[model samples]
Target: MQSTYTEGLNPEQKKAVLHHDGPLLILAGAGSGKTRVLTHRIAHLVEEKGVAPWQILAITFTNKAAKEMRDRLERMVGARVHDMWVSTFHASCVRMLRSHIEKLGMGYHSNFVIFDSADQQTVVKSCVKELRLSDANFPPRGVLSVISNAKNEMLTSDRFQSLNAADYRLSKIADIYTRYQRILVQSNALDFDDILMLTVQLFEKHPDVLTSYQDKFRYILVDEYQDTNNVQYLLVSQLAKRYRNICVVGDDDQSIYKFRGADIRNILDFEKDFKDAVVIKLEENYRSTQHILEAANQVIKNNRGRKGKTLFTQKTSENKVTLLAAGDEHEEARMVAEHILWLKSTTDYAFKDFTILYRTNAQSRVFEDVFLRQAVPYRIYGGLRFYERKEIKDIMAYLRLV
Candidate 1:
């Protein structure tokens, strides 16, 4: 009922939000009110387009993003989102598998345990030890990584064996893979990857289940589409095949998950996957100033094979961005410390207002050492994080065990 949903949007953004039917892609540029458009699009579907809340499914990559989407929708449509599904892919898979994994005819029914990395490592180590393989020869973590890659490719033990049945190392890995899966089944457990792979398995092997889901969720929205892996891409392809009411929002330039095996081509070749797709570009930057947008656009435009888009901001500022060149990393750290002190003394900015960005985890040590030497009160923000730490996972495992 609120026309304000489309009030702040530009022409392209309004087009994306109002396009209710068919496959749609929103190439939301960085700082271009990406999340706002997504939420408004969902709100538009429910409030203005007469779509039932339960028929919509919004999938995000991370729990934090999923939570944000849920919170935003709750504010927009109140309690209706409780019936609709707005959660991470893993969480949605877990929810589906909980109800229908019993359909797989595997012994893994409801109440089957979900194994964390440490628990999965223990199971792999046991299998390695039973096979009399030395840790140096076949490390558990490395073997687990291979299995994970295979699962992400949607390969089963039989399929993997068919591909690598001859090589000795792969033969051993195949044996380990089968053995590890057997151990998981025996323990009534599935690893994190198995959650998604098993959901796909249930869908493929059981047509009724897939049909029910396709019927239930008529509209699907995927945030951060560029960061999806092969298995996730396949899952979305299958789910969205029947309805084809999929709206994916992502920027190819923001596809930085390549190191984590994210398929950047998923966003790059999106139109090819969904034929006759509607593509909308949101180039008006809502967060960044004009100078910042210009600097970022200059750097990202050099990359080839990305969709051509330019970001512009109406916000004008006299402040110009400075690029500092230091002789060495130590001097760079010192300069950063000096700058932070200067900002604190002159400007109204506090230490918390500053965020030190680094390219890699190794770079964090330089900041830590510098902050300590400079007697600056600063806390490192990124790491395994709160819920991902070993201790917290161990506690959850204990509770689940009970």
Candidate 2:
């Protein structure tokens, strides 16, 4: 008996979608239709499992992923999808804080402003200047990073101070963190890290609020569980403490946000955390060829900390994966440009069909230069080329002032 929502899902995906009770862990491999599983599970819960839409809380890593899940659920479950709580972790925190922030006795009203990175930097710079700290020794960005990391680890300014009392540099950073928090409070504002940190604080300090939410959202689903930091893990743990009906979807091999304080142990220790949890591995990839999956599996299997799963695909392609080596970034860019040109000249592919990816934005300069010199017209995706211009930034600053 296949429900409308669960139709066409693979056995592993169906197992993940149908298991509505208890803690579940879905080891979703790359291109393995994890999004489909997530969306279909929500739809199945609402459409077939007789679960109230409001009882489900589906959390993802990014706003875009959240929106995509919501849109997919809407197509399957009609307007009832609106009742389901589908949002990024930050968004969910913001929503909760809006209702219960003042309850924390933090002097912040529901209308507190959420400061962006720029605003946070401005405040950090002001704190540094007021404290008479040398800019070179205690850079604003460095100070902010410390504060952000502390928040990610669920450490308050005082707690961080106490923990790092022996370290002189951290002691100074603790002072900056304390003052920076005071200024944010005075301004009736919170930065991104504060959003998560305060929500955890709100839940911890106010048990009634936590209980209400815990009772309301009976089923909790978190995407990208591998990328959750300590604070995020605590937040989810608190909310799902009562129901214990939590489902986390992540590939430990794909955990790549360590620099952003993502703790891989959250996903790795899922079984230990929920001893009775059901684990399903979604290893059937639909996007890549068999050869590519084999190559990726070989590389990823070397990671000792991961929950082991090998990805397999039905797609058959004889093309072998090519390994390219270059002396430096310049040579790499040139090699890429030359290869792309060669492909365009030999094959029927157009320039629009070929896409180049790099590790960071800084690495794009070499590629952009090479492409320009080679007369290869290219567009940078996700780069703020226009808004990041000096004149454009100046105009924006002036507008904000006016």
Candidate 3:
């Protein structure tokens, strides 16, 4: 007597979707249909478990992810999905702040602008010039990164200044940080990081507001749990404190976001963070051959101080992993081009089926040179990320006004 929502889910996935009582951590391996599990869990909560749609919250890091989840949930649960809140932390914070903004004691309205990096730099530059500091040594870009890191750590100017009172160089950056924040407030605005920081502050300073949301979102699902930082962890902890029905899905082996200050500890010690937590591992991978999964597991096992798990696959294929050695990058690029050309010539696979990944943008140049010389029909798959491009930032800043 399997419900339609639970159909086709593996035992591990079914366990995750049905365990709706307490904190649950699903170590979902790649290609394990975690999205299917997530959406179905939401559908189960609404349709089977007698949970209201508005009482459940699904959080992801990107709007694209939020939109995709909403689209899939709509298909699963029909029009009733509109009551649930599916959005990024920033977008969710903006919504919360829109209603309870006056609680901050700051003179900001719901229509306050959200500053982009470009807009932040403009404020930083103004502050540096006003302070008569040399932009060559203490550039706005560097200062902006400092400010961002501080905000990500839930640090205020006063906290940061107290921590680095003796360092003269930091003193200057602290001044800039304070001045930049003042400018944002004066302009009735918040930067991207400010959104989360302010939300946590709102909860901490105003327990009534936190209690309201804690009561509202009885069930919470966080995707990409490994990529959560301190502020995000705080915000989630506060919201999930009351009912404690929080489900986080992530793989510690896939935690490659240390550069962005993502705390791998959040996923590594999920049980300690939440009481009576149930950990589920979705080890069955539907994509790739068993050989590939074994190879990937072998490579990732060398990482120290990580939760141990191996991915398995039922899909058997003739594909084998190969390693190629080349004297130079040109040779490497040329070898890849030859392989792709051979793949195209013999197999039914098209150019779309083949992919070449590099460590950085510079590495793509050698491949581009090879593709041009070989006249290989190919397309590079990346450029500056969406928020990194100037045009996109400009448009985003303008949209923040609305």
The most accurate candidate by lDDT is 2
Which has the greatest TM-score?
2
Which window of 10 residues has the lowest lDDT sum in candidate 2? 383-392
Q: Over the stretch 112-202, how does candidate 3's per-residue lDDT look in tens digits?
A: 9888988989999999999999999789889988888899999999898988889998988999998888898899999999999999999
| Model 1 agreement with the true structure over 1-402: per-residue lDDT tens digits | 246588967888888888878999999998888888889989988988889998999999889998998899899989998988999998999999989888898788788989999998898898889899888989988999899989999998888888998898988888899999999998899998999899888899998899999998899999999899998998898899999999999999999987666899998899999888999998998888999999998999999999999999999999889999999998998999999999999999999999888887667667667888898777666684334569878998999999
> In candidate 3, which residue ranges exceed 4 Å CA deviation?
345-349, 384-402
Per-model TM values vs. the true structure: 0.90, 0.94, 0.92
The residue ranges of model 2 lying beyond 4 angstroms of the native Cα positions read 384-402
lDDT, model 2, position 354 = 87
Candidate 1 regions exceeding 4 Å error are: 1-4, 345-348, 384-402
As a whole number from 0 to 100, the lDDT of residue 374 in candidate 1 is: 90
Cα lDDT computed for each candidate against the true fold: 0.89, 0.91, 0.90
What is the Cα-based lDDT of residue 309 in candidate 3? Answer: 82
